[model samples]
Target: ISPQTCTEGFAYDRRARQCIDVDECRTLPDACRGDMRCVNQNGGYLPEIPADPEPPSYPRVRTTAQCILGYTPAEDGTCNDIDECETNSHHCNPTQVCINTAGGYTCSCTEGYWLIGGQCQDIDECRYGYCQQLCANVPGSYSCSCNPGFILNTDSRTCQDVDECADEPCTHACFNTYGSFMCNCDEGFELAADGTSCIDLDECSFSEFLCQHRCVNTPGSFSCVCPLGYYVFEDGRSCEDINECDTGNNTCTTAQVCFNFQGGHTCLDPLQCHSPYIEVSDNQCMCSAENPACRDKPFTILYRHMDLSSGRSVPADIFQMQATTRYPGAFYIFQIKSGNEGREFYMRQTSNVSATLVLSRPIKGPREVVLDLEMVTVNNVINFRGSSIIRLTIFVSEHPF
Candidate 1:
């Protein structure tokens, strides 16, 4: 028996020992030419008929000659070009474009994209320096941006500085700089930690001598104050004593004279001398030798006045009396003879020539005290004795300070 022979479009299988129908569409490259559809039969292949009927001038006819993949046999017995794009027969990706040619078609990527590995991919355009400050890349395009404290200009590619001070970000003053701003305060105020608010400056706390008497803190400023009996000087920081006698602000009776002192004034009686004593100077008196009453009187009398605040501490030395002349072999003794009725004052002799009047007790005032202080000197070697008196007048004020 001879080997079995297979017909066209059929292949003999050695393993199965039978003839199988061949797939011309997969085996033959030019089996289905152009846009024509192909079908396989038991022993052969046939081309599918066109959807439209053949025209009268171009009638369908059977032919034995074969054509290439992109051409077909027409009724006139000649190969003709086919449009694969028009028939939707081209193999292209969804993102690719199908362009028809005379007999074939091509696939390409759309705008803003490129073809790679049989697929379409987006192109990055931000690699180029197109923005002045910043740039952002999108799928198909790029955008330009600016950094903080800057704005895009009309050109859309350049950046400009923004004026932050125009919005009044500071409480007192504002200054604009390149891409930034600064805040400042007024003359007497200071900038707060927030950089946008103002706070009062405590000028008084900066120095102890800002004011002579007292310092007062105000909003954004400071003021100097003086105590009661004093006035603020023109310099605005020192204190000056108020002259009540010159300003006529003193309260004195008609029988008294107003005398001004450092921080106060006093009302004093006019100096007078009686018969046994004669006035020699404004504050001194001498005894008359011709009068009999002068025999027991002091040799001289001196008038002195002092002003003090009320409630003075005890044992305070208020006044000092010194002899103007010294003599050889002369010793002196001092005493507060008359004003000791209340035991409020005493005398302490520091030396043979000087003595101090001391307050033995506290004295409350708007009151006055007159004390007769006597100093006696004796010289046993010369067999002589002499004495003098000081009529001391004390005026205590009503206030302690």
Candidate 2:
């Protein structure tokens, strides 16, 4: 047989030496319709009538070209995009708009959003420096915020300091800083440890001595005091002697004259005792007039003769005198320097204010005697009486010698 080519429906027959139609449906009975049997014909095959599963229904005519809703028909019978954005048949997201393409429609994000993958997502609007302090990106929007110690301004994009010192929280002076505040005290006060309150400062306790001698602390000030034997000066800071004599504040007797000395005073008797008596002490007299009765007084008297006429020892009553003082338990120590007999002057304490001086020998003078007396306390503090001389006389008779 000669080789021959055939089309899809016919085969080359070597016996006939030509191409003829082959009934594929008759050769393969299951090939014509899935619901019916195959019938043979002259050069082709046909499908037998199939019994309807539903009476007079044709299975609702199955279609080969599938198309989505709101689509236009193409020339080859495929579905094409219907431009739903213009036709108003789209249900796209409100934030997005519909876009028509080759065989379907698409939803694209608007100005603030973008199309990502198959969905429309929000774009980050905060990337455009929308806030002055802080910016937050949200679902299609953005917000502004402030850092600590700041508040959002009226514009909703800028920030401002919160002014934390406005309430006057400091107890004394308040100073407003950049974002905070500080408290301070005045010159004489100090800030407390807690830094909120003020307290008074005691300068007396800190300074070595606020006063010259003695210091006293007041609420906000200090004072100075003078020690004993001194007086506070006009400046109230220094000490000075009082000069009791000049001030007439002394306790000396009127019979005595007051003399002022540094921090003290002295009193002096201005008159010697009248005659018929003789001066024996700075302030007293003894009766040297020849009267036995006067000599017999409880007190002692002293006499000094200008001449040594009689070798007879004069009466022991001839050399005693008294000096008075103001201090209790006063002691008198008489000091005399004449001849060796000057040592014989003795002083005695008879009372708080009274003392007696006696000599071991009567004064026989052609010589001068210096006498000193000191009035002192038990502790050796000198009080009053001082030193002076006494006088006497001698009767000279011729041969009566």
Candidate 3:
């Protein structure tokens, strides 16, 4: 009767001139249970049941077969677990690993990465502040580093400084510092350009240092060397006078004396008597212009006691005299001022300028006679007289004792 009635569950109503479903369930109160829904059909109603509240038994109302998360419906109309890892149905990141659970899939971060908010993220292990010196953050780990001239210790988190001078790297002196070292030379040495070896300093070349005579350079020090006549002083930098005379290093003769000066020595010749006045044998004379003569003039004579025995006329002592300027026939007058002991001693002229003495005494044990003799030679032409004095000692003993 109306166009709206052609549709299902619609009926024509003449009072309102519209198509509508009959309210059969509402009018019939005992049509369906309380928990069941009522559905209007073509001139009838249908009952819709709800799920059951208890387990291990079918529901009070029938329901369609469905699958939960990570599961799919099988050919037998039963729920089956799905392998999301293999089927690629998981919603995990590409860098993460997907694993199948009982009814869901799980996501895990790979190596060198971590998981955050169901995604794979790079972990910064350096944020832990475990490194002692310098730290480098890798994906999921950390590394320790050190500065130049240093090395890392056994512990990965800490660093240690290196000592480059421990192995005797320097030729002279080795100095150690933080993370490095240096080579130094002594006072008399210079460091080489390579900074390891040392070179000897030329102390002789400098005018301010070293000895005044000579200078010698050694490995790490210098020495002051003196010349032949000088020696090194106590300070080791200056030269001192070497007393060659006192040290017995001189070659002065017996007649000379050695004198030491600043850098050398002198051999001085001592004084001696002149030619005419002969020097005393085996002795030197200190002669000068003022006093040029020797102190004593001595001559010796010998007489045998057997020859001078009693009643013997042979002469025992003979004396010879000469002058620097002498005439052939000049006569010399002689006088004995001493040795006038008795008639036992007799003196007589033997020649023009010579004399002899005879001892006529019988010596008992031993006897010595000292005589002071004087001679005067006169020149008759001008009446000029010259005199000489002499002192002599004679011994008269048996066997010439």
TM-score of each: 0.55, 0.35, 0.43
Worst 10 residues of 3 by lDDT: 300-309
TM-score of 1: 0.55
Global lDDT of each candidate: 0.79, 0.57, 0.62
- Kindly list the per-residue Cα lDDT of model 1 for residues 1-401, writing each as its tens digit: 11345544457788887657677767778776656667664445666655766622332323333344577657654457788888899998998989887768899887768899988888776666767889887776677889888999998888999999999999989999887789999988999989889999999999987887689999888999876677888999887768898898989887788876545787777779887789998788989766788886888999988877678888899999888878899989888768778898888999889999999898887677889999988889999687899998887865543
Model 3 TM-score, all chains together:
0.43
Best candidate, lDDT = 1
How would the candidate models be sorted by TM-score, starting from the highest? 1, 3, 2
Better of 1 and 3 by lDDT: 1
Q: Which residue pairs come into collision in candidate 1? A: none
lDDT accuracy of residue 91 in candidate 1: 97
Sort by lDDT, top down from the best: 1, 3, 2
Error of 3 at 49 (Å): 31
Model 2, 1-401: lDDT tens digits are: 23345433456688897556677675774665566666554334556656767745433322233333555556654446788778877788776788887545788776667777666788786888888778999887788999876889989998887776688777778887655668988766788898878887776687655555677766446677765546878888766666677788988898887755333445645646564556566556666436665543323333343322222243332234345434454554443323334454465555544555554555542233444343322324554333333333332211111
In model 1, which range of ten residues has the least summed lDDT?
Answer: 55-64
lDDT, candidate 3, 291-375, per-residue tens: 3342233121211111121232444464444443566546677666567666555556666676655554544323455665656
In candidate 2, list every pair of residues with a backbone clash.
none
